[model samples]
Every structure is written in C-alpha cells, then in structure tokens.
Target: MLLVLVFSLLATCSTAEEKAPADSTPLRLTDVSTAEAFINSAEVVVVGFFKADEGNGFKEFLAAIEEVKTLPAALCSVKEVWTNYSINSDTITIFRKADLHQENLQLSKIKKLDSDGLVRFLTINDIRYITEYNQASAVGLFQSKVKVHLLLFANRGSTDYKPLKERLGALAPRYSGKMLFVLINGKEKANERALGYFNLKSSDLPRVGIYDGESDKTWLMAPGEISIERVQNFCDSFVTGELQKEKQAGESEAKNEL
Candidate 1:
C-alpha cells in the first residue's frame, strides 16, 4: 500500500523576554509573505529548519516531517511547523515544501476505514484519543488474567519506536484480551501524576506504562526495550509467579474451609 505523507509547518520564534541561549543561533522566518501564500495554496505545509548542531537538529526535523507522511487523509489539511531554536527577527528562514500531488497519491493508497474501526485501530496503535479529562482514567490494558487500568503513554518521536510498536502489536493476536497502551507526554500533568506513582521519570518525550487495576501498581516498559518476546515473557513471569502466588494465598482459607 502507498503511504501518504502529510506535511505540517512547525516554526518557533524567540520573544524578547526569552533570550537566545549561548552557542545556539536564533532562527528567523524570512519569507513570511511567500509562506503565507504557500500555506494558502497547499493542502498541507511543513516549513521549519533546525540548526545543524551536534544534537542532530536536522535529523529530528526530518523525522517529524516523516511522521506527517503516515498521517491519515483526514489530518492532511492541517499544517505542521516545528523548530528547536527560537526565531529572532534577523535570522534567515529556510523552508522545505512537501509535494501535495505526491502526498495525495500516497494517501490514495491507504485503505480508509469507518469511524469505529478507525478509533479501535488508533487505540490499538497506542495513539491518544481522549476527548475529555475523565476518559484518561478509563481501563485500557491487561496483563495475564487481570485487567490493567492505566492511561496510555507512547513515545512516537523516537527513531527506534517502530520496532517496539510492532512487537506490542503482535500481542493482540497472541492475547485476545484487552490491552491498553497509552501514549504519554512527559510534560503533561496527567502523565506526570501517573509516572510519579511509579517513581519513574522519562527524559524522553514518549514512553509506555502498565498500571494494575486494584492496587494501582504501575510497571513501566522502557521505550527501546518493548518487544513481543520480551513483553510476553515478562507477563508470564509476573502472572504465573507473583500474581498466581497472591491468588493462591488468598484462596487458601477457602480451600481449608471446604
């Protein structure tokens, strides 16, 4: 299937209050007039330039743009812009234009699904689909015979994220039970609360976690470490050993009574 790439312009400008840090040059948007015209003309516009620094700014920018390519057709109309450096007045801005025709052709190749199926697919893929704050508490994931009640967190930005996702995806076939994968943004308050409970913090932008339903015990799955073989093995050890031991202990009195 052909993949559709949607380009959104992500730009960051530095304000007077926020001084540009030393060693990093400010980025400026030079061609606002042309950019406005381009934005108006194209269905999707991704215009942003990063400093060629040791942090691999250009690589991060390109990866962000690549994400737009996988976006479904419904999201094509939105323009995405991003920049690591604050834009100053004098800095020269460089913009890259994504070919709309090519994007449309790629989009055409993707099979469209109905609303319900799309929602389920997105949820299974660990995409955040919360419409309200309360929905954040909804029970989504499971481990062994127990329901895992925790919000989903995923780091979609990491270059190594795809392999982890693929591994998690395979879990659905092996375990038909409900398994929630919440996409977490560490900066968000809800995510912070969830992570705090587990005494964990992620310096990375995206990460995943599994929370126990009753005790609220949280098990964090590190971003690069998630895989079908690893996850399944972990679940088996936890459930068949720890969880089973607890259950058996709880049932001992009943067995004695019988």
Candidate 2:
C-alpha cells in the first residue's frame, strides 16, 4: 500500500509538469545581431518584431509586414526584444528600430550594397552630408519636372500611424529625385508653421499634396487619399514633360538670381 501511494504521487507530479505551459523563450541576442547584419546587406529590409502578447491581439502583423517589403531599404529587422517572435518562411519582416536598440549595441556601420554587392556605409554623417548637399542644390525649391509628394500628418493620436508610416516609407525609392517630405506635426509650433506655410485650414487634418517642382506650384493630389499609384502617375507626368513650361519658368528665375 505504501509503495502504491508513492508511485501514484510521482505519476501525478509528472503529469502536472507535462501539462503546464512552458516559460516563453527569451530573444536570442546573437540571432538579432546576425539578422541585422544580414539585413544591412539587402536593398530592402522589412523588420517585423513584436511581443507575443501584442501579436496575439493583432492578426494583421504579417499582412502589414508583406506590404512594407515593396519599399527600398538595406535591411529590415523583425524580431522581438527580450522575447521570441513567430517568424516563418512566408513572413515578411521589416526592420524595427526598437528591437535594434534593445540589443544595447550601437550601429557601428550600415553597409548599403549595390546590385553587384559592392557595399557602402549609409552613416549619419553621410545622411547629413546628402541632406546638406540636396538643400544647397535647392532640390526642394526647384520645379522638378517630377511631381513632389508630401504627406503631412499628426502622429499623436492614431494607432494606425505606425503602419501608415511604414507603408509610406516603402514608397521612398519610387519618389527618389522627386521631392518627398513627411511632415510630422507632433508639435504645436511646428504644425502651425506648416499650416501657415501651406495655407492649410483646420479641415485638412490629413493631406497629401503634389507639387510641380519645375512650376513651383502645388495641387491637392488627394486631400485624405493615400493612393500610391495616383501619386506615382502624377510624378511620371512631370518626368514626361507635362509640366515642362512651369519648370523652365522656375529655372529661368533661379538662373537670373545667379
């Protein structure tokens, strides 16, 4: 009887241990670093890392990731910080800045590769230099024979803002050499200045404007519409000389100043 009781207790303990939920696995820091290195080599990287809890509530994470893969970036990181992500062969993960920071590793260099695999660092100093050069070139002020699109929005109140930003970010390469600016109206003063500069009214909560770079005129491409195709077509027309007269006039004025 004593032997039987002891056997029964052991069996019960083993069963309980087998049935209990296992502890969540912590994110592998080394894997994150390796993945980051892999991403930095590609032309487009979409990272998709989310907490298991956050992911459980949103089934659209995968879909959101797939959408961002269409853009041009060297790398994308999509793994959870301090937690594991359910990624698979079909998963489209874009790089997330949050997970990168969680590793406590400073980004020493970001190597952007060309089609032939030649690498170049996309550094902060490089970005600043490019920006300064572009500004000095009056790249924004010039009438682009290319349509310039601007998405002006406030990031304070919307849960959808991140996904939206990601989607818009993917479209960056398509608008390359064409003026594009994401006006994040996070500050009252900045928002007011943007409003005054653009002559926007309160009714324009979210607006997408298309500017003729050569003409120095802007048109309401879509006030609230985030149509990538429409914006692309608008830009294509400028490239094709639909706005040549306006561009020439602006260039003439600019030349006179010199």
Candidate 3:
C-alpha cells in the first residue's frame, strides 16, 4: 500500500508540465530545516513533494494554488524532507497547524488530473487555526475531522474584532484537534442565523461559544468579558465533560423541584 502511494509523482507524468499561471510562485524547500520552517510559518501550507519541479502535478499544483490565493505553497524535491513526512516519493500534502493534520494528495491515484481537481484538494484541506466563517471556508471547517468548535462572535469592523481574533488564533494551537476556533462576523447578514442559533444578537457581540458536533449541543459562555483565562476555562470544562455534567445536574435539580 505504502509503495504504491510513494511511487514517483514525476515518473507518472504522461504530459509535459503545463505552464502554471503566475498568480503565486511556489517556494522551493531544499532541506528539512527549510521545510520545517515553512510548515510552521503559516497556519496552513501546501507542500508538493516531487522529484523535479516540472514533474507530474507540479504544474497543476502551482495552478491550483493560484486559484485558492489564501494558502502558501512550496515545492520540495529533497528525499530527506519527503522521508520526514513519511512519504517515499512524491505527493502534495496540506500541512495544517490547527488540527495537526497532514492531508496527502497523490496524482496517480486521482481519476482526474487537472488544475480544477487540485484546487478542490487545496480548498477542502484549507482548515486553519483561526478560519473565518464563510461559504468557501465552511466546507473545510465542517469536513474537518475535529468535530468540536470554539466560536468567537464579533462584528467585523468593531474596535475589538481583530484583536480578539488574533488572541484566539494564538490560543487555538493549544487545543489543536480538540477544538476548531472560528471567527463569526456578526455584521454579515448570513451569520445572523448562527448568532440566533446561540440565542445571541449582534448587540451581544464579542462573545464566546462552544458547539459540540457529536452531541449537537451548544454552549455559550456566561455573559462576561471574553478574557483568555475565561475562554481557556470554558474549553477545559468542555474537554473534561464538566459542562455536560453541569447541564445534566441542573436538569436533575429542576426535576426534583417539580
């Protein structure tokens, strides 16, 4: 299985490299150190491991990246770097820091070999530590293996919006696979529904909420300042199942009272 996957991505190129549009130039990653730096340099990065720059899917990789425009892409022909990733030969991989996921795309295995399909691959795996909620990005967020989300609701142009978003981005990696931190722009009319689902309004901007996909349960932090310590405690409460237990206990108490 492994052998079939790593089979040289370049060797299977039946066609010459198509000229990748110059929308974005892919960085050349020559060594393991450079590769590591590049991987950590962004919340998400697309790295193509090919035997040569002009190899199979190389052009497609470049062209596909041009279409996405949000991710940084790199090309690594070094076998040393390939081994570090546990792939033998050539594959395009999405290295995401948020969930610590390495999504691999092999050209030989793909039925369609075109820039369109490659673009889909890049977008679908574009999950980041702090992904803004949107139509295109929502695909990646919902499809993510991590089912839980820590949501930050803030009006886009508000005073504290960017600062709160950055604060959560730095905290996201700490939770990694446990939760996907998302920014919900309250100003966007489309997001009004999300705010309503949490029984919140735009007036209640700059709030924190947790949604557990597995149980379809939603939690909103008790109205207060959205401090890092408070948010961290809320996340910890969720992870420890304390939040669920508390809810259940409250229900039990109500039943007793009745």
Writing each residue's lDDT as its tens digit, candidate 1 over 47-155 gives 3332323222333333433433322211111122222223321111222121111111121223642334333322222222111112211222221133442233443
**TM accuracy, model 1:** 0.35
* Candidate topping TM-score: 3
RMSD of each: 18.4, 22.4, 10.0
Candidate 3 residue lDDT tens string, 138-177: 6677677898999998887789988998888888888998
How well is each residue in 39-118 modelled by candidate 2, as lDDT tens digits? 55433333323333233312343333233223223222344422343443222233322112111112212243122211
lDDT of each: 0.34, 0.36, 0.78
lDDT of the structure predicted as candidate 2: 0.36
Question: How accurate locally is residue 94 in candidate 1, as Cα lDDT from 0 to 100?
Answer: 22
Task: Specify the poorest-scoring 10-residue window by lDDT in model 2.
Answer: 121-130
Error of 3 at 57 (Å): 1.8
Candidate 1 wrong stretches, greater than 4 Å: 1-146, 149-153, 187-189, 204-209, 221-224, 243-258
Judge candidate 1 at residue 88 and give its lDDT. Answer: 23
Worst 10 residues of 1 by lDDT: 1-10
TM-score per candidate, in order?
0.35, 0.36, 0.81
For model 3, the stretches where C-alpha displacement exceeds 4 angstroms are: 1-23, 251-258
Candidate 2's TM-score reads 0.36
